[model samples]
Target: TFKYVDTDHDGVMVKGELAAVFDYLDVDHDGKLSYAEYTKYDGASAESQLTHDVFNHFDTNKDGFLQRTEYVDTLFSQMDHNGDGQVTRHDYDHFFTNVVHHEMHQGHNGR
Candidate 1:
């Protein structure tokens, strides 16, 4: 999943590489995502509230659009749970499986 998100193959996930994921989520192809568009993203699933919160957290500029840097930073921060500046497989899996899944299930009621 990390490889897929890191579209640039730059050996590290950067703002540019994260644009691929943003593009995928921006279903309207408007170059920016509104709250409605974000909710519709496939990754959103039943965790619409958490997804919404995540989006807001990443919209650092507060312009209601998630710029590339914000998106990349948000994802990297989440993946690097220990704040050790490196995302180990254990950290990645913990965030992916536990954090994301927990949020998703919370919204879906264990759908």
Candidate 2:
């Protein structure tokens, strides 16, 4: 699941990873995930864990919404592919492409 979802293998998750999950779960592409996608993919485990993990990490100040720092820092790390601490759109697209490929393989592998 991590391999399929982690995209660039940077040991963390970014928008690409989240978008992959969302795309899988948001079959209707309504810009949000719903129960239908969960059941469709048999992703109960991933859904539950994703919910829990998101709450634990993004809620750094225990606030409901993510702060700018938390959101940027979390996604910025992997987006900075060169480790220079700045992220360009290329980094994002590259990671996203990997995410899509990985997900395709996972679906083919039946896990």
Candidate 3:
């Protein structure tokens, strides 16, 4: 999935690549991602509601919208577990397997 997201094949996820990802998730082509857009990956089920809450957690500015900068920064920070300032495939895998799973579990538990 990391390689898939790295459309530029640049070994690291740059802001532009991350923006493209956000655009894909936005669905509506709007500049910001609403809860519906953010949670659309799993359809309009309960899981999507949980995912929406997770998206809100990423909205650090509390603006009720996910700006490109916020999405990129949150993704990079989560994936860059080693603090190397780069999100390699290894980091992405680690993040997807560990952080995402943990977050999902927490969400399921209503944390």
Candidate 4:
């Protein structure tokens, strides 16, 4: 999930991109992602829920706070959609776009 969002794969999800993801999930615009904000991004669909699930999974192992490895690994798994251990900007953009749309939809529905 982090890899999908983290295009540079620098081991940390950037504020700009992370903020985008948060905006998508934080339907209420509360400026932070609570469990509910996180849940809004999750679902049964792979495209919709993969990144969010991976984020949550990583968070659980390390105090529910995401460090660089957790961020990178989550993103790496997402960008490496084919599981070939590499990623391109196309993958990152695609995933990010999806998340943004998903978040917008959630916000509309929540309202």
Candidate 5:
């Protein structure tokens, strides 16, 4: 995971490397992120067509953008089981595993 962000392999995530991630996410290259682009997962595990619902969940204010307040606060809150406003490695591991498992279960059931 760290390696994904640290493209230089120097154990550091410089601004350029991180910017590349953002650019990749912005498929249209318009420099603005739409909910559709932001949640478009390219993994072939499943159709993942339901991911747009995640944008609606995060966009509590009906705005077209997923503001940091809603995205960071709500998402981290879900992952931060202890409610300490921070997600530890343990929290991330469990949260990620559960998310993957849930997605897989849903995919199997849906298909």
Candidate 6:
């Protein structure tokens, strides 16, 4: 998956990697994500308040759609820790490790 993120094979990650993610997620390739495209679950997912909250969290532009930059920038905020616009492997590892660690220590094991 790192290779997928490292599209340039340069060992560093820029917003382009996240751009690819946005593209893959843009089911219709319309350059933006609709509510359904973003939270595709059962018939009620798109109408759920939690889904709306999550979608609005990433729709920073308040445009009712998830723009590519909006999606990428939202994630990049956590990945690009040094403000250099590039996420090294270390950054990737640290980010996920912390995420996993948080979940692991959140009191639930495996249900």
* C-alpha local distance difference test of each model: 0.67, 0.52, 0.74, 0.55, 0.58, 0.74
Please give, for residues 1-111, the per-residue lDDT of candidate 2 as tens digits: 445546677755555565565566666665543334444553445456444443344445665444444444554565567786544456667744674345445655784
Local error of candidate 4 at 25, Å? 23
Tens digits of per-residue lDDT for model 3, 42-104: 354536554666677688899988887778777777777777766788778887687877887
For model 6, the local distance difference test gives: 0.74
Residue-wise lDDT of candidate 6 within 5-107, one digit each (tens)?
Answer: 7888899989978787678778998889988777752343776654575567678789889998787887677778889999888888886577534544452
Looking at model 6, which ten-residue stretch has the lowest summed lDDT?
A: 100-109
lDDT of 4 at 42: 35
By TM-score rank, best first, the candidates go 3, 6, 1, 5, 4, 2
Highest TM-score, which number? 3
TM-scores, in order shown?
0.50, 0.34, 0.65, 0.37, 0.45, 0.57
Q: 3 or 5, which is superior by lDDT?
A: 3
Off by over 4 Å in 4: 1-64, 103-111
- The backbone clash count of each candidate, in order, is 0, 0, 0, 7, 0, 0
lDDT of 4 by residue, 1-111 (tens): 546456467754444565466557666664444554465553424345544554465564645545444444565576556675545566556666785456656755886
Candidate that beats the other on TM-score, 3 or 4, i.e. the better one:
3
